[model samples]
Target: MFKPDGNYPLQLHGFLRDQNKIWTLSRENYEALKNVQTHTFDVEGNVVKVQFNPARMTSTSAKVDAASISTRRCFLCRENRPPEQNDFHLDEDFYVLVNPYPIFPEHFTIPLKEHLPQLIEGRIMELVRITSELTDEYVVFYNGPKCGASAPDHFHFQAGNKDFLPVFEKGGIKKEKSIWTKSLFSAEVSGIDDGLRKYILIESGSPESITAVFTHFDQAYRDFRDDDTEPLYNLVCARDGDNFRLLVLLREKHRPSYYFAEGLGQILLSPASVDVCGVCITPRQEDFYKVKEEIIKEIFNEVFISSDQLKKLEEII
Candidate 1:
């Protein structure tokens, strides 16, 4: 049942505990979270966390191509979902369920009820609303189809514990000031190129206005890329009081060259919204140990849009 006046975080905690009792896979994975190893690398003064989470191998190495997706059963589909996995109704269109393969201590996947392609063009407002409503306990994020989404065939959003990502930390986005700032409608838009990452930060007190500004920016970005499809990017949104902060991380490619490199050269790392935001996941233990500052720089440099691209995009928007 959906309770508008109830505490969402408390409700989610209850839901998670209930699921763990019935779902052995989810229970085991959540238990395994206790042993997940992590280390940090200082990248240009910003701390980037690298987590050795072997359970994430399924997501890190997912085959999202058209042919592969068509052949496999859609896991997000209601009929195909595991019988033990129950969900809370977020609204008429979506359901909130515990992610069996979790990255956060308390992770949740909110997928649309109808089977739909994972695209954010017309759904930015939905993201804004979800972020705002759940602001008290969680931060919402979206991984673009070609970016980090394992189930690109399904439209969904993910929520994790607030301040879990490094980007929300002191030296992350807070230290990286805006290169360009402008006000469109009732929203404040800023362009940030912090050497390692390029971002479009949008802040607004009103949801409608934020959506309008994002739409305008989206069209400008589409024109800049000259692509009919949605531009490559990942999004993170957090709300504080009446204000909402949305970070749009631009992308040049989905995976780094090392990901495709064979044998010893290979690093099975696939960065999405979470990785771009600062905590990168390496599903293989070897890759976790192999990653260094230079490697992190290389992977980040290869995937994120260049400084010149961000500048041009700023002008276009």
Candidate 2:
């Protein structure tokens, strides 16, 4: 199903008539076709149609066996096979490829040539610099392996524009004064507030300010753990006129409970820890509706608090 090269299924041509255009389908038309069938088991030993595609998604257990391994042989990094021939190519130190299963029409990913996990190094700064200068309207983000990265073997980041995701369309922090605020979600768990009191911007519109901010945050993180590994870090920096707002998150020890809620009778359609907690791009209405709020809350619990760590967190909360 995945065709990293531009030569994807011919059916995709029907799905995407033109690559340049955004929001190709109207809301009504999009909603109508997004409906797909889901099957669930009933107590009476029969199958039931509990929810429609646009309603909720039936949770299924994730194949965590392969992902749990400490060591992985990354084909992307090793150049065993690259993304697509025409669509992407190797730059000086990175390989550029258009995301084959892009949520946004023209989504692209720039991955490191080596399989190093440490992104706080100078390499990330170079990537941000290149993207900011070349990308049309896209915003780039990094997902730490433990945070939400599906492919933890190779270090890579995601890029998409504001038109694709509703959450990034407008910004100024969700609220004017609250440390924790919510937007995009009608419910409370749609978003939760967590933060790093300090941040350093490595580069920005003004090279000088970028240098200052980067120095500040980097040193703080190093100081946080003189001998221990700091939590996996995720950060999003957006261009706003002459300045930028850098959103940074430090991964913690707790994993959420909703992650294990898969396969329940009811459709618990929440996205994984990455999509809900981090930047998730959903192209279809089905994904939005089917992804249940309860499921998302459970995922949050799992990401931040593992079963073993839950009791310990209870004492602090």
Q: In terms of TM-score, which candidate is strongest?
A: 1
**Which model scores highest in lDDT?**
1
Looking at model 2, report the run of 10 residues with the lowest lDDT sum.
183-192
- What TM-score does model 1 achieve against the real structure? 0.96
TM-score of each: 0.96, 0.56
* lDDT against the true structure, each candidate: 0.87, 0.40
The residue-by-residue lDDT of candidate 2 on 1-317, one tens digit each, is 11123332232333333332334233233344345333232211211122333311211222223455355445445455432322233345665554444444444566776777634555445534544543335566766555555565567776655344433444323433223322211111111232211112232355334434444444555554452343455655555444443445444532334333355433333332224323332333444355444443443444442333322222221
> After TM-score superposition, what is the CA distance of residue 129 in candidate 2 from its true location, in Å?
0.6
Local accuracy of candidate 1 as per-residue lDDT tens digits, 1-317: 11256567788889999999999999999999878899898886667999999889999999999999999999888899899999898777889989999989999999999999999989998998888768646889999999999899999999998778887875577524677888888788888877678889888888888888889888988888889798887988888777888889999999999999999999999999989888899999999999988999989999998887777776787
Alpha-carbon runs more than 4 Å astray in model 1: 1-3
Model 2 TM-score on a 0 to 1 scale: 0.56
